[model samples]
Target chain A: MRIFVHTTYNHRDYLKRLYAKIVDVLKDSGVMVITNHDHEGKEDLTKSEIERMSDAGENVLDKMDGIIIEASVQDSEVGYLLAYAIAQKKPILYLYEKHSGAKSVMGYFTNSKIPDSVKIQVYEEPDLPAILSDFLHRIETGESKDLPTIKFTLRITPQIERFLKLKAKQYRTTKADYLRDKVIKKYMEGDEK
Target chain B: MAKSRSKIALLFFGGSGIQTGDGRIFEVTKKEEITAWLKELPELGILADIEPVFVFGGPASEVTPALWSALAKKIGELYPSVDGVVVTHGIDTIVYTGAMLSFMLHNLGKPVVLTTSPLAKEMQSPADSEGLVSDYRNLGVRANLINALQVATMNLGEVVIMHGNRVMRANQTIKSIGPGQNFFEPIGEGLLGKVDFGIKLFGHVRERGKGKLKVDAALDDHVCTMRIQPASHAEQIARMIASGCRALMLRSYSTLPYPQSFIPYLRLAQEKGIPVVCHNLFALKSTRANEEYILINDMTYEAALTKCMWVLGKTREREEFRKLLYRDVAGERIKANV
Candidate 1:
């Protein structure tokens, strides 16, 4: 599978590290992989030359099978391609670094409305490997799953329990499934529950 | 017999234990001490004739369901005629808790002041639990108009109300970062500003939509950001594209009026069917992409846009999230297009 990757230059050092890890993770998934790193003519090119390089990048996107992005860059350069993918409603996998005080890079997203076409995953340094593995597994298996199963022991009130039960029935799903799904979905979505 | 004082709901969430006027901070958080503290309020002429409704979250519990249920119940019970709500909580998730109340009770006519202290309630700070009660009482009368749309972070020395998705924290008199190097200097702009009370609750509350106001306990997730560089390889874009990401926020370089080179990713995203959000550029100018294909990230980080996107990710009408993304609120023209 061909995957178009976008990253800021600041994270270039970690790029190779993440890329190598990704290849290792997907090696046995029976998916033939093509990467953004495989493209040509990306050296210190001039202005017009850079345009051609963009054209080259577009050509790769034209042929690639999937798209992945490292979207921690506050000021992103591939706005054209990024905008294009959004306009096309492509299935994008977004990853970011976990920090105690996260300094958001994308002022646009931070300042504006989030589009519907994006799938977001947040991972810490220690857990990137596992998170990436899960993502790859889902892509390979075609599983539409929810994640980050953190167990929150709630001190339930009778009325609250009744509310949950009613909600479960209203949704036409089992109470266990409803609560579990709601918790997982809320966690993944970062709801203010 | 004459009717008792108006039911001034004073929900206290401390511990399951019952208290006297204890000097210990941790000790006062007990049920007895919390109840005593609450009981003292009506006598002090602060809540004057108002009944105190104390709701504890257990001594160790930060914000359990009991706490939320109490809050939600109070809101449901009061609706339009609520006088106000006083939330006393530990400093751990106080700000987040405040934000949740602000969003969940979007159309709230009454004020819900969320207060906390690094020092214990028993500690000898200028603004102890008693002082906090004084502040809330004063706030009820003085704060005739408040930005109800978003949470207002109020401390002992400061009462910062977020306006235009921007949170300004300072003393009651000041609004900007003054000469004193205060820690709460203005940061990023807030997405949603103070909600207007005069505006009918129906349009604003219903328009904001219904969902859970889950206080995120853990935010230790990674957000790998990258800028598209010149001579950037599509192969690089391809790897990044297929690497299985959570979400991608593609920003155009502010320097460039038109970033034509990056157009290929649009075609790639179209084929991939991923949600790629564009920032800092006009959506109409983004000619290569379609509306369904492109999403506009147009709010401040402090705004609910990020939270909204995360919420919309779970719904069956995930596609409709795009439509809801750029709706106007708090007198701001929130558009998905740049």
Candidate 2:
């Protein structure tokens, strides 16, 4: 699974160490991780990489299976990204440091309607690895309760129906699942008006 | 009770300006797609009635002198119909374009603001990765465009660059390096205004309604620039003049005397009826202005270079070139010390 890790800029040394630890735990689990922090003395992204990322927009988040944000700092930017990630329907693990003194702006979400894919947890530094491990396990197993579904029928050409049936059979899946995974999911993630 | 929004003519040059919904840089292929992208930022609609004119789609480095002339002409055409104009450009060459426009568009009215969303790599800092992430995604571009749109409706009248939180005169601006919040800095007292709680125009800024708009877009791009150094040879200067270099802008050492080796080439350039403009002359030292070379101080390198191109396009006659070069056009030169 692929994941993205983000955090605020407050409490520099502590957060940097936390980022390094989180990256280590994710890498140890054989999961691909993209992070905003420069934990390993890597040079910042090149001009071409920045252009590619800017052009990609929320599609970058769409490619990630989940997101992990350290919200111990009160940052409006983190809040904005959190909203975008939720809109992308990516499973999010919002981790706040226990007794960090500074309240996270993520607390504002508590009064609002929160989605099932979001899990907010306050933890001591020692609990991070375990929390991340459990979250990854749940993500891999699809343990989150499925969101409510609505049924709709669409009329399609016979050629399209035949193509869907053939694709589903070749992929060893039902036609509905094939449409949901391949067609609808992609359409919903892209170019939404 | 609501105020009427300003009608802004937005000339889109496509350099990190718009990111489409489907993860692609806007190429201006479809007009409808441009409208759709604009809808994503509704605050722009609230700020002004933007009439987007697609100029071109490419990196700003590809921009040429001819393109600058074309853009100036386009803005001239749109000048009468819109309250103001904003050009979206690439940060790489936005200052050059701004300086060129400041000279090309002879105006005494409405703000002609040039701005861009700088590349993320240019502003990234490993020490501030969290802030960089937010800036890279949307805050940087969004804030710049919104500010540019507002500045377009201001009382200022001149070509200016609105970047970060500073409004700088185009001719006096210089590109800055490192991971600072601002990518450009003014050469002298080049800052015309700023954006804080609200936009504040400095008293020295040219106000609207001084005169009618005029387009003097003629530019001769044959001028070359060279920085003088200890190991520099006169042959290098000779070769430039031999290769049909119309004008030469030599950057002199700030503290050191003008190199004795290049004196012969200065005489050679004068003998060939070519104007050699020297910039960055020592301000404290008295450098006598001779017929061999013209001395320039208190002007940006960009202004000196583009002014050479503009003057060359107008007149190459020995006295006429010097007169126009020393002329304070668009406030490029503070005081013609020569």
Candidate 3:
């Protein structure tokens, strides 16, 4: 099973343990670690490596079966990456390091109004591996993807359709294309889902 | 009466916002204290001509089976006269009251709104505190009362909890825990509707039955509830089996079976023909374990517990018991997969 793990790029010291912990947790699972960072303490990854990581991350996520995100440190790029994963319909399991005010941020990923909002869980360092293992198993067993995507048509006003057309043309995109992009971007940015 | 005017039955049980001689230093009969409190809210008459009927006094936890029965009877008797009924209850066990009424009252096509507040500073403190000085208008809690009354008038036609500025089906909502924050959250979905400007309905309101309202005050409160934990004591369950009640709502961990020790007691209960409903676990479909022994509590714990009381009043027959558990009574159960 291929699983993509995303974390904050801003925190070099934090990822020192986070990367190692994730590696330790996912050790025996045989799931491919997309973000294979050489976290030998604070020199987390090179500047060129970080640049290379984004494209690699996107590519890995494309081929991966599931995603495990460490949201101990909030980052905008991480949010966008998580949102991108949701837009792709990839089942995700978000991990939050147990902190006093963890519940506040945990709800965004867990109890999201977003249709693809993943299961957000709180864990101490020791429980990370077990939680990841259970999450991966759920993905393997199709428990995480309990509800399959279904297509349906929604009737809208001519004016609304015209507005969409105008906006889509202005944005140099199709109405259908822009709608999905705008909604996903808005949902990920916490503007609306 | 104006075209918009609604005859709302305001049944007061001395919850927050109602002085009930608690927010002030005085002594009076329960009925008089409630009536006096109503007189203080003369402006409330502008919203809806609320016919204040005093049910009980004290915190919501003081509500008993007799009280619920009496309140149910009152709502039934007044159902014909009023456009709807707004129940003023304490927040402590308000959801339980809501669940009880959802089962106890049938064919209720009028809104049965339950509303309450945190024990406001005025209600908690005496004359010495600064709260009493500012609480002359009952603070904004009385405004919340009027909001509930307004909701009762909206033809909502459902048992709803009007708290945290949102109205949700009584049977589907559970009380959120926090200080001065008692929000009723719907089990699976979002709120039924928001109680904000213009009374926007969320289209979640169920269609009312096309028949006369039926009242079944026969609730067997002998039913009790227990949440299953990793180290659950089977002896306590055995003791409960020996003498506690006729039925039990066992809140399981993910609707799974109890510990091995609890199996014998559960088997014993099953043997004695008692209905031990394992509740509060979400099960859109029955699993193998569910079929073998465990009963999935697909409904909110509050609803499941109250439904147990309601069902126990009907029958102990295994077939009937199973039927009612899975039945869509008041839209409580999550829709089973087709």
TM-score each candidate: 0.33, 0.60, 0.58
- TM-score of chain A by itself in each prediction: 0.46, 0.66, 0.55
The TM-score that candidate 3 achieves is 0.58
- True contacts preserved, each candidate? 0.00, 0.00, 0.00
Window of ten residues with lowest summed lDDT in model 2 chain B? B120-129
Question: Considering every candidate listed, which one attains the maximal TM-score?
Answer: 2
lDDT tens readout by residue for model 2, A141-186: 6665553255679899999999999987654346876687656755
Candidate 2 residue-wise lDDT, B3-116, digit = tens: 344789988775544433343434343345566556545445535678988786667778888988999999999998898899888878888888889888886498999988
What RMSD does model 1 have? 28.9
Better of 2 and 3 by lDDT: 2
- Candidate 2 docks with a DockQ of 0.02
Question: What lDDT does each candidate get?
Answer: 0.38, 0.71, 0.63
lDDT of 1 by residue, A1-193 (tens): 5455554445455645665666555445545454434252223224574354232211224333345565544222233234334333344566666542334222323214444445566556567667656656554454432222344676989998898899775543456656655555436645643
Tens-digit per-residue lDDT, A126-160, candidate 3: 78777888787777667654333345577999999
Between the candidate structures 1 and 2, which one is better when assessed by lDDT?
A: 2
The 10-residue segment with the lowest total lDDT in model 1 chain B: B141-150
